[model samples]
Target: MGGTSSELRDLTNRLYERAEAYGMEVKTGKSKIMVSSTTNTSADITMNGEKLEELTKY
Candidate 1:
């Protein structure tokens, strides 16, 4: 996991791209982000340019 939102966002985007290249689809509606840190910063994560939902303690 990343130490910050931006880092995680970049990582997530790359993952989505790589997955698509392999004919894999990331179902954003069912996807979630779980941050392990104490920080309250939110990551604007997206797949196919759609924002992903964030979850706490999941």
Candidate 2:
């Protein structure tokens, strides 16, 4: 989890809502989200245990 916990928290909330609507639940403990940065460094962004792709020089 990186790139501010607030951002990740928001995303997680949205995902949870969507899943509930579809009779599915997002088990953070069981589910895995990965974040990565696409750039020369290719840094990985992990937020709230979720991984997302981050573009450099954006």
TM-score leader: 1
Cα TM-score per model: 0.78, 0.43
For residue 3, model 1's alpha carbon misses the true position, in angstroms, by: 0.8
Candidate 2 C-alpha error for residue 50, in Å: 15
lDDT of 2 by residue, 1-58 (tens): 4474466557666777788899986655565544444434444434345665454452
**Model 1 reaches what TM-score against the true structure?**
0.78
lDDT: which candidate is best?
Answer: 1
Q: List residue ranges in candidate 2 displaced over 4 A.
A: 32-58
Whole-model Cα lDDT per candidate? Answer: 0.81, 0.56
Output the lDDT of residue 26, model 2: 62
